[model samples]
Target: MMRRLLTLPLIGCLGACSLTPALQRPPAPVPASFPVASAVPASAPASAVPASALGWRAMFGDPRLQRLIDLALENNRDLRLATLNVQAARARSNIEGAASLPTVGLDATHSRERTLATDATSRELDRQTGVNVALSAFELDLFGRVRTLSEAAFARYLASEQGRDAAQIALVGAVADAYFTQRLADEQLRLSERTLTDWRQSLELARLLKQAEQNSSLDVAQAEGQVALAEADVEGRRRALAEADNALQLLVGSELPGDLPPAVSLERQPVIARLPAGLPADLLLTRPDLRQAEQMLVAANADVGAARAAFFPQISLTASFGYASASLGSLFDPAREVWRFAPQISQPLFQGGRLRAELRLAEVRKSEAVAQYERAIQVAFREVADALAGTATFDRQIEAQRRAVSATQRSLELSELRYRAGLDGRLDLLDAQRQLYASRQALLDLRRAEIANRVALYKALGGGLHADSDDAAAAPTESRG
Candidate 1:
């Protein structure tokens, strides 16, 4: 009996040998290189410091923006929830891992029984007490089902970590985008306020000229109309500023302090450093969403192995070691010692084709994961290419807009001068003023677009996150417009 007990270890060794299929990584369905603009500076080598290494501070030139980014990372509800999901997944993986090992439990019991008197026997009673350590329904993993499931769960835990990284990257990008918008709103408010002041001065001049009989009531009415339009613009800008402030507060996860520092004008906003348009395969692998998808594939592959194992026979073991006696005082007596050991195997000869269906389901899930993984890669590739193409076009647009603003400025001056000399009408002066205003606003919008494009590119390139070793979200990409 002792010898047979010793053989249990050898039985375990045989039982644990895996029958699962060999694992292979799915091929990435992506282009060999990124579609980028010719103007992209190729001076930066592929091995240059990744944006993930540069902290958010290094990416943002403005101190105020840096503070906001830092605060958001610490307090954003979405980021906090993502981190919690990682913890939950890890806990679930741990629970799955325990299934591979036998569950040992301690048990103690006492019993009393009485026999009724019979024709040939007197009444009798019996009492017994016992204590034992028991192992229950432990699957021997003969075909690696338990181990395969554990491994799959572990992969899902890892995937959750990558999901967190993706969330952090998104949070960083969102805060930056919102901050840029608020700055744009502030600049517009200033522009409108200044324009309103100038319009008021022009209105006053018209009134004075009309009083002196140098201008007619028509001039006063036109000047008054321009002043009213400028006032409306100022009011509209004030509303925009308020809305922008509310948006910033929402992203920050708390109310902003009144003393928060002012931002630089849109034109003076610092640019984020550009990543190399080209990257090595390893660098491309840094995207968290891609890695998450890959992990899902890994988990699915392991599920297939577990499903296959289900088609084979299962081995289970149950055992107990204990002491028992007719009386409580003798429970520990040497002769009272007892033990049991049982090993069983069951083959699924008939289960209404349930095993077959499960196996097919696992295969289907694995195929779906493969397609999802590939799709993530494709999306990542397109985002990077779009950002690259947009950057070059934005530069041209900004230049053209600046030139247009300048031309309108010159036109406004000429219109005012010709009107004063009575060579042009009031309508021409008003039209020139309107053109200059529109051009300046357009120029500001273009600048904001260029800045936003940089943020988008940073996200597309996987936010410089490296999930293999680092746990925290990698530092932000350097800010460059």
Candidate 2:
């Protein structure tokens, strides 16, 4: 009677599982056009970026930089953590997939029992043994509950994979930024030391002239002050160089090579590549963070389906086959054999409104995910616009800084000659020297900013370090060709 009662609901649940509602994707709010002007110059042509290409090796031409990126990818702790996250997500997805299938197991048992006679017919001792192979406590996913859960898990796994790619891109950008900063610091340090040496020589000459009564004591004092200022600048630059070196080492996840190649000259201007003016919407499909957001939204949608499915009845099946006897030798006898099969179903008829509340909660989470997806799109658009604007402005700034540096250099030479000829005061020469140094530093800074902006642009366009199905399709053709 009890078995029949359990079986009724199981049949009903199986019937309900067949009727599934259509799953819907939350609507995305995409603008018709980017809000900012698309005025990138035609001088820079759009470079073709392959989806499967990753690492700084191909993007950055420098072999040393490629080595650094490789080291970072291997040893960086954050990247390792991201890798572990992907593994965890994959394992979770596997676990979820297993829930959709029936489970079967084999069992074997032997037992003995002894008891005092409690009644006239009671036995004094008992022994039993059994062996069985059957399905047990397997829940049938009649309402698509397991399927929905598995889908959510799969999306989460994809998100984890994208998260790893995001980390890799960020790591590459950081290494490049640090490398440029280090080079700039080295340049400043060299300039300071050279200036300091010149100041020392000038000071010695001033002292000699003063002793010969050819110049005043004030001239000697002024020369000493110049030497002190140059020395101070040298010390400051040295500290900056050390800091930059440490930062680069940290990014590479190791100490700088003992024979680390000489620092690249910051003065060498990199040719900025022109990217495509109007990118296709599909370009963003490869952006790791955007892909991650989309996956999360997909998972949330699946959760809603799973939660809704929970409102229906749940069904389970259990079966067992075994033998038992008072003596171990009789356990395998035909008369001792026994079998049982039980099917069960449960309905949440009343739970203080808990089921309704859970369904509402799932809906709320799904809504939140939709909002996040939209926000991610907005952020991505803004990043691209800002990078484009920066790239445009940086070109003008670089040209202007170059001109300023050249003019300052000429002014410094003229001022020094005037001072030696007594046509200009020592203060004038000092001012010109300060102006020249400032202009040179500013030019270095501008160049670094320009390169950094290019990096940002690449990141914004989702050009760096990505993998997708398109890449897979292209691989075979390329190999064959």
Going through the candidates in the order shown, the clash numbers are: 9, 2
lDDT of model 2 at position 108: 80
CA displacement after TM-score superposition, residue 26 of candidate 2 (Å): 5.7
Give the alpha carbon lDDT tens digit for every residue of 286-317 in model 1: 67887788888889989999998988888899
Q: Quote each prediction's TM-score.
A: 0.88, 0.85
TM-score of 2: 0.85
Residues 1-481 of candidate 2 have per-residue lDDT tens digits of 9999998898677646632234455444565555565455676533554433432444565556666777787788888999999999999999999988878887887666777787867767666667787887888787888888998899999889888988887887888788888878888888788878877887898888888998788878887888898889899999998999899889888776766544457555343445543543543464678778778877887888888888888888998877766677777899988888999999888889987887788788888977887787777777767777777787777889889989998998999899889898777876787788788878878877877776776766665563232443353321100
After superposition on all CA atoms, how large is the RMSD of candidate 2?
4.9
Candidate of highest lDDT: 1
**RMSD to the native, candidate 1?**
4.8
Q: Give the Cα error of residue 188 in candidate 1, in Å.
A: 1.0
In angstroms, give how far residue 14 of model 1 lies from its true place.
5.7
The pairs that clash in candidate 1 are 59-479, 271-479, 271-480, 271-481, 272-479, 272-480, 272-481, 273-479, 273-480
- Candidate 1's C-alpha runs over 4 A off are 1-19, 40-48, 111-126, 464-481
